[model samples]
Target: MLFPVLALIPATRTEPSSLLKLLAGEFAAQVAATWPEPHAAFLAAPAARRHLTCLALALGRDLPPIAERLLGGRLRHAIRLVLDPAPSGLERLLGRLGELAWDAEDYRTLLRLLAQRAPAKVLRHAQQVEPGAVRRLAGLPEPMGEAVGLALELTAEGVLVLREAYDALRLRDGPEAADVAASGWARAGSGKALFEAVRDDLTPEPLAPPHAGTTHLRPLRSKAELREAARRYRNCLGDRLSDAATGWQAFYEWEGPPGAIIGIQRDPIFGWRLEEARVGGNGAVPEAAREAIVSELALMGVHVGRSGWRLERLLRDDVGRGYRYWPPSQDVAEAFGDED
Candidate 1:
């Protein structure tokens, strides 16, 4: 019964009256709803309900009883910021944090990060990672703050992967974490560069669903493996370890003379598409090797870019790549014939 309209004004503290009105409406609706047993546990708990307001109650209902015990009187301010406005782009994250091991002080740090307006990606990832890990980084006022303030320099690609990679680097390099953090935050530093610099040293997380690699196309499973491949190919494959680490892109090396690397990335539109096939030192991929690579990848249900158009009479399938009206290449065969 709450928020019959999907899009309402965002509940920022811009105007006291407007925020209060919205709060009142939400409260009335929620109070009227029937929450039984554990869902209404907060309402029945020893803690006062003064701080739980607006959509927070909706989030509150889903929290496991342990959260109720740990966060006695009030939900953290950061939790409030993330829970309100209904479509915070973080509703999914809220649902998954029912098991958060809350410390009053830790919650305060989270609040500080939000009040200072950390990037949405950073906040989202913070919620996803271990709270203790966040506490560690939050304590590093020098580099992480520099990392946060100079976001434009480092770019989101670097910050997006910061927490996970930071944790990994801490585990692997230990005392060197400070230097590593500086590498990302110094005026000359960047997130991408930081990742590239320590890609081999950083540990690799297990790929979800665990891909079984072929003899010729073994998936890049470790950062050490990435370093070896990058050296052999003389390509920037090392820079793409984050992509492979996340399983968004799977990097596989061809075991042979004139060695090659194939990048298969998951595409929302096309399941899995062959994004790259590069030879050693970024040389042009030979047609014979290209054919063999494509053939083997196809057997694994992976397709190349816009790759599924059936070969028609007298049309070479490999030469064309584009949508109906767009041109994938300047080749005459692609312009006049089906390319996608």
Candidate 2:
């Protein structure tokens, strides 16, 4: 039992060296208080390894019970988060894990440990939160994984935009992509405006002018923050009321007859990029409504991008039943089947 736990900790205090040790030692002290002198004596044998091993054994025997006590029954849920294949919650969840310690170094160590132990999960998580992280993590040789991991902990949001840039470069120029990307990442600094330089470098361009309303870039902090921004946008609309729902990638809400659509995506430099509100109707958007939408976003401090807002229509389904939200490449034949 102790060997497994011991094996996980680095002898040189590298990677998750600090966090794993701290958690192990703290857990040992807690269990030692409850056990009899003999069973718990190993916990205080005046040597780090002995104590860690003793504690690991005790916790292994009663993991669920101990986890419940430590995490208020949320330990199972947290562990489940670790097992999840999706990359979206890795950084946030890992941070939540070490939040009990409230030390930046501890949080970073835990992050490094998780990535080392579960590279795939870490890769996805970093990709979801900050593509630069995935690029940085991927390009690194084994030794630098931990060091870069620490850097990511500090600039998680700043690196989100790097994913697309890195991916584009990778597609064009395979393994050698890391050299150029890493240089950009090194100069990324605090991540603000980090993507401004690479936005054009992307094969297709991230800030391409939209055919619809003007594209404005608003860097919101979180999904919740985007919703709040949408709410403020509604307030700016004055009396117009429409049903609204916010999703991970975009915010869709009905406002009056024409309705409105705001697209959202992750950006490491600015956090989240929100498109300027667009008229969501089949017909031309009324000038009044367009002004109202643009005005509200501007007042809220969202930066207008390269293009100005314009009235444009989205493609609709045949028979005009509703807007066709799916991409053009979608296989409609497979979707509806040969039965029709």
Candidate 3:
């Protein structure tokens, strides 16, 4: 008997009718509060249970508190009963309710509860429901903008259904549907553009490795060696200079022996200057070398305006005075000296 009743309602049926009977039964039990007697009655007559369930669901806010409590419990029980692989005595009682109608609020509350408590059941039920209702329900407001956006995004196909609804509403009302459609289109376009911009911003650029034939150097053998080298270079230069001061600098030329270059120079104000030095191959000199130079200098704590020729010349002069500190055998002075 239970099997026949379950079979009567197709799995796809989403109308309020299918569950109406069960809902009504629960509501009646709540209203009566007699407990065992009503429960026995519900079990005895599955058709009666079905009618009661439908009535209860339709009652909505009109239902008393006792009805709500009883109905809630019964709803939970019906859900569990439906989960059983084999039809139970309560199965027929679970059926009988035909198609049910749910407004936006009802759909939202039901969906939330389903997502939290019975996700699988919710999905199954959604499939059974009317496509139009499902589409509308999918568009219901979400607590978070992202969630709403995602819902709209996932149900893009449902837009047609919404459009139909809009049309119907418009016929019944005025230009409400047209306005909604326009707003939806505008928002979607803006969101898409914003998403693309963010995506582009996050995309990484391809990194090119150092050019072939470029010289490279490791740092000094130890911090002590580096300090001692700095001190010695400073002594040779005989000047107190800014780190940007090219008279004294440290760098590894990517030519010849490929090792450190330390410069010692005399400054007008500072008696001695020590600086790190670097020698670049012809390839290192760019058409916009000044821009590159300024960019590199900025990275090294040197502040200079983009078009400051005076500052550029000063930097070039200081860099020229910086000497290669690597041993003669390792120096790129000869190999990398070409002006080009």
Candidate 4:
């Protein structure tokens, strides 16, 4: 157990080279003493060879001749382990590598490690610190393009847009626009021209005249309608709501009223539900009634916020729920009589 655990620590140290050598010797002694022959054989086995090679590399010393001899028949397994280690082991190896002077192979190895692990910050640092090395590694004849491309694709939508533009304008009508668009497209693709064209065309058409019999409805129309529409729209998003809901819930949970239950109320005309929570500052409704209201609103896909407040206010005043009064205490019924 101790040998396995101690094997994890990289042999490189902050001390002088001599001290590292001493430390490595001590570690080796511990392994020899504490680990049985079977355990040593297992470590030297084809399946475990890479871990051992990594251990030797990290130690900055050649493995014992005996260990090397054991590895001869397990070259493939050793190669695989060196190629991929446990996360902790990989991290340790990287940290050890960082101490060495730059080498092309070392840079390539680091690039491969980053591509596999998606260590974005480390990769960025590596790119910045050794740009030429990164470029060389990128140009290497390897499947590294897949990893590099994936990273770019994940974070560079702007680059994609540029590529699309270049593709779109590769051939076009007018020489001037075509020239400009073609240059831009070469930078990305012809899609850029098409994108620009679509954007220009999509500029809002003059509002069509309302039909003679049609009564004008405002874009969102009323606050109630807006709130309901937002709610319904959000519900259609389903699991997509998890992120939005989490953010909203966290905000309201801390800043909004205590004991406030959120809810929704649908607009009868638009079939949209107004959703919101009942807070203490507002007139008191029974806990059950508030919950019921909020639940109905949520089921109708309403979330509580500014729009919710507007809807709630509208419901209370326009629907006559606002003027309705409840006794604060059942025991003192007359004390709160006629309260709005």
Best by lDDT: 1
* C-alpha lDDT of residue 102 in model 3: 33
- Using Cα atoms with residue i matched to residue i, what is each candidate's TM-score against the true structure? 0.37, 0.25, 0.22, 0.21
Greater TM-score among 1 and 3 belongs to 1
How well is each residue in 158-260 modelled by candidate 4, as lDDT tens digits? 4444344434443334345544533332332233443444333222222221111111112222223323443543432222222232222111110122333
lDDT values, one for every candidate? 0.51, 0.39, 0.35, 0.35
Residue 83 error, candidate 1, Å: 51
lDDT of 1 by residue, 185-285 (tens): 44436545555544444635526423465667777777777778898779888788778777788777766455788777776656776767777776666
Q: When superposed on Cα atoms, how far off is each prediction in RMSD?
A: 17.6, 20.4, 21.6, 18.6
In model 3, the runs with Cα more than 4 Å from the true position are 1-38, 43-126, 129-290, 293-340
- Count steric clashes of candidate 2: 7
Error of 1 at 55 (Å): 52
TM-score for candidate 1: 0.37
Candidate 1 ranges beyond 4 A from true positions? 1-210, 307-340
Give per-residue CA lDDT, model 2, range 23-142, as digits (tens): 444453433444322332333332322322332344244443443233333433434423344234442443323212223333243345455644545544542333344444544433
Each model's number of backbone clashes? 1, 7, 43, 25
Quote the positional error of residue 299 for candidate 3 in Å: 18
